[model samples]
Target: MRGLSRGPPAARPPRPPGRNGPAYTPQRMADVSAPEPPKPPPTLPDAEIAALREAGRAWEKAPGRSSAGPEVAPGLDVAETRGRPGEHYVRIVRSQTQGFEPVAPGWLEATPRAIAPDTDFGRIRRRLRTALLGSPLSIHRVLHERLDKVRALPVLSSDALSSVAYATEQIVLILAVAGTAAISADLLPIMGVIALLIIIVCLSYRQTIKAYPQGGGSYIVAKDNLGPVAGLIAGSALMTDYILTVAVSVASGYDQIQSVFPAAVHYRVAACITVVVLIAVANLRGLRQAGNIFAAPTYLFIGAIILTVTVNLFRLITGSIHPTGTSIHIPMTESFTDLGGMVLVLLFLKAFSSGCSALTGIEAISDGILAFKVPEWRNARTTLTIMGTLCVVMFCGITIGTEVL
Candidate 1:
């Protein structure tokens, strides 16, 4: 291998004086080039512009005519028609870009007419509903629709207050099974216990209102404090109570009706359903409306109860009314005293449970605190207190009235 020393490599070409690769001219480009002045929007040629004007004038003269005019621009349907008196309107029905076309000099722009709902029945239904329930209120109107305490007391307290009507009857029915002796012996004590319970429950819920102003009742409180499961259980229990309350109220109401109009007993089921539906419809109309619907009767009933109780008390004080001498003959085998302590205790418990129905709607105020006017929690608390006091008075009065009258 002959070493042909190709002469030492020619000296490497020097990089131009800066760093390695290319020499830096260091010419600074402008960081942001000035934005090109916006191009003037394209305009129609004078011929086309003049034709459009002429066509607009022609359309104004014969506004009723429809035509496929001479093609000026592709997909431009030019028609001459009256729109607003002085201004030109153009409606581009079709375009390649599928974009809004500029209003031409003299054409009318037609707006599509509104399509109605599919069924006449729908309109009929809506009209009928409005006639029945009144027009629906908007969200902004919710505050206006809120209840004051006067209205709220009847609306929310109806269930509780109405319970007083039947509560005494229920207690008496249970006691009557054990005879008048058991009734005379047991009614006062049971009434006292129920009255105390009402106070405790009412006070508890007032605190609940204070604590949870947003107003979820037991469900919200339980969920936040205990857990979701507990809240669900509480909610379920409330729902069950509501259902039973409705059922019991309707049945009891119909019973009274039947007593008044004996023929109504033949239509008991129909009558009960009608009452339930009426109540549900009233409530659906909005709480304020329901309050109005119920207010008169509720107050009347309250007045009657109060008057009856007052008169009874007065008569008793004056010694004008003596205790009802109605007596139930008990068998020697089942004498009142022979009824064991266990039997008496159970009977009292049953009577107490029946009377506790008076307390059923107590939580309604707490649950619906948001429905109250401003200072919802405070109004709610005050309403709860008032409701409780009224209930206590009414319950005790009714119980005593039952005994003496």
Candidate 2:
């Protein structure tokens, strides 16, 4: 067997060297390289440049999104991408995007969107109607169900009742200033006028309760029958009246309580306001709860006055009664006069008007008619009747008692 030779092949000879490295210069190649740097990112065409400007303006005015992405603008529906990573490129949407279309030049003004109509009336009406008259029971059943709650009704009813106390105090104060001699016989007729006004206001409010069982009271009545301005006036007046009711009622209550406990007299205004806030909170718990809380005091007050009046009337009739503190003999002032002049008449009218403050709370029932359980209007009317009867008895007894004793 012959062994083959294992040997390296011969290396080629080195050619002549150029400046840096050995290289053979072959036949010269034709010059093939082109001359410009990649043309400055194909300049956006004129039409496209105009489109980009318009799109930029549209984007400025349009709704915004939080992140970077193509977005529709108000005038330009289609958005174009402007660049790629590390190189500038204009990215435009293909012609097929839905709702995308070209806008004519100068067509950039945006129309304001139309406002939507409110649909809250149906909901409000449903709520109010449910509150006012939706229950199925009869008036008697409703009243019976709420009988326990009748106590707090006095907090509402007692405003007028308590005015008796205020009237007496005011009259005494007036007499103190003008002198006992200035206290005239005309006070009798003035008292009568005041009584009549109370009755009138009470009855008028009863009608209001029956008509507008919704809670706005005078405001509701005036608005439904008259107009918004009238309603506004009524609302303002009612608000003022409620505030005065608290001031006057609590003030009078403070005076009565203070007569017995002198220490509380100095804080009368704050005490009155406190009672008003308490009453508002109790009423907020529900109408029934307030009625229940107030009813007993009201009845007790009425009964106490009635018994006192009856006993006094009996004493007067039997000729055994004398006025309290009468032996002190208040001295008459120089202002005292018997002349039946216009000034005297005006004074009488003013006094009567002031006394008529008793009628302020007559509107409460009207304001709270919807709070009745069922047959709301009828129950409200019944409540009104009870209130009226009690008012008449209280007013007459107080006036008569004042005159006699």
Candidate 3:
């Protein structure tokens, strides 16, 4: 059956405009007529405030200000007070006023006591923290404790120095994928480029330290010279870089641990967590203590690397040790001939970029200029130079050693 057709629905008439620019319902009308919110209380005048303070001081100083009883003259008195039935005691009295009143001569002084947190948990937490991190230092103590170049080198340059432990491996691993020929052809060039970059960066940061001794690092530099946006970007990038640095450093150390003790390979996550916690606790022990704690390891690592490299070079020069050169034959999986010129160029570029990880912490000295002793910028610059030199030497030495033997 067909349904009857219907016409379009009619539109309702618009409401008349109200005084407030729109149609008013009962709620709107009420809101429009409602009283305004109470205004904020007016501030007291300076003269009135001063007068109030004066009155308060006068009240505080009044002779009869004591709430216990009326004030009495200062004098010595021995009063017999009943303690119990048929028992009495003699009490020595001096000033009658209490609360901030001065005591008479020979009167025992009240011992000063510190107010501590009431909860046992709070006390336990505080004591545990103290045990783990050592006593907290006052601002004055921390300020007086500045780093010398010797100590500052390890503290500020550790991250950059530590990266050398793996940066060469990263470069080699990338190049080796293309075949041994690629490694022989590209490794030295990549190392040279990275070293040059390092020198340039170190010099540039020396200038940065001179210009910005106050040391906010890239954030302050970018903010002042460029804009806030650029500063924020630089700051965020630094945070991300730091997080990755910690992760990489920890992983590298873990790999070394596994190499020494194969059983440790099973507890990778646990070991990483433990190491991170220990590092955090060490840092919390204050900067001076942290430096002292880390100084030994940094120096030991430098010495070991230098000694090993020296011995290897000596042996090579004397022909006492034979070199293990890379194979010239192409691998079946991947070969340079198959990759073509552009791909090989890209591969070399990738390896060079990977090797640049050694430069990760180069800005640390500039960023922490105030961490050094007197003539902070000079000391920091010196430390930076030392770090750069060590990095270049160790890096090149390691690459050359790997290539030869």
Candidate 4:
């Protein structure tokens, strides 16, 4: 005990990493020290302020834009003599009444510089955009080339047109649930009516696209004829329809694939998410590239349907195929009303309405009218007409092919 007391206590061993200890470094130490906010600079003289305002007015009143943006050549204002220009600091408070004070003087003495494409953060952003999409198109080059009728039809019509793949399936699924009642028999007349409705909807849209060449679909119609409230309602409804349509399309497309390869069912979310992300990225690239990317698939789909329809119609007309559409059973049912006449009427109405949902995505074309090239209205109108006719023919063809197949 005497020997231990003679010397200072030996230093304790370094603590291991745990609740009491963490790894430390000079960088971390620096980060921990909070830097003081920079102070605002002194106010400018009234003469200099007046000169800046005059320069601003001159820039605004300038007849045209110079190569380097606006030329504010009213007079030169004196800059601060003490420090380098624009090297001061200021705080930007969010309050409207308390704006950030100008940190530099005589900013209006020189013409504004056009931002160089390769400057600072701009270079990083452009590379990112180019990597994700393609080269950026100029404002004038946007919608620069008109889509000939062949390209426009597929470009504008894909959403409505792609419905053929599943619309008939949905209709059949609904009717066949009646079970053993020869449900397929009613498919023809119901489908014929649906086909007619599709045509009518297309015709109405065609007229609308022509009248409002700067298109915004039902929203525009409501805004133009009715009031803003009506326009808002239409817009909200259209948005709801678009979301639901995408959900249904994703689900149905996934299910179709899942039926063939059961493994795909496990990755359903991933598959759908990938599709959405790809579509978003493609579109953000600008209209020309997006159209180019979409045109091929859309036309291929159209071509396949046309071929199938052509083959089936040819067989039917040649009497080589038997017509199975006329043999399905019909069912009678009632709600709590014991199937009243009005109830049956409502059922037919409901069925027709359900089938008519195939027409949901038709409004997409109108939303993109400006994407049409020179003579925008005329090209948009023509594209719209072609879209409508294609939608009608495809919907009808698919319905008929359900019987033919």
By TM-score, the candidates rank as 3, 1, 4, 2
Candidate 1 lDDT at 171 equals 93
Q: List model 2 lDDT by residue over 1-405, tens digit each.
A: 278886798888777777886554543322333555865664779899889999988877787635577655545534555666778666665332433333554243221111112368856765675464343344444565442225425745677666665675455455444445445464566567767777787678777765666654778878988999999999999899878877877776777789899898688777877888887766554456567777777788888888987888888889998878744446644454543455555665566667666666777776766666576767777776777677766766776777666
Full-model lDDT, candidate 2? 0.65
Per-residue alpha-carbon lDDT of model 3 for 149-202, expressed as tens digits?
Answer: 888988899999999989999998888778777888889889899999999988
For model 2, what is the alpha-carbon lDDT of residue 12?
85
* Cα error of candidate 4 at position 306, Å: 1.2
- Please give, for residues 20-82, the per-residue lDDT of candidate 4 as tens digits: 668556788788889989998749988998999999989988898555766553233334344
Evaluated against the true structure, the overall lDDT of model 4 is 0.71
- lDDT of each model, Cα atoms only? 0.82, 0.65, 0.83, 0.71
Residue 347, candidate 4: alpha-carbon lDDT: 49
Candidate 3 pairs with clashing backbones: none
Best by lDDT: 3
Off by over 4 Å in 2: 1-152, 175-178, 181-184, 213-216, 266-270, 325-340
- In the order shown, the candidates' Cα RMSDs to the true structure are 17.6, 23.7, 22.9, 25.0
Error of 1 at 17 (Å): 32
The predicted structure with the larger TM-score, 2 or 4, is 4
Question: Lowest summed lDDT over 10 consecutive residues: which window, candidate 3?
Answer: 108-117
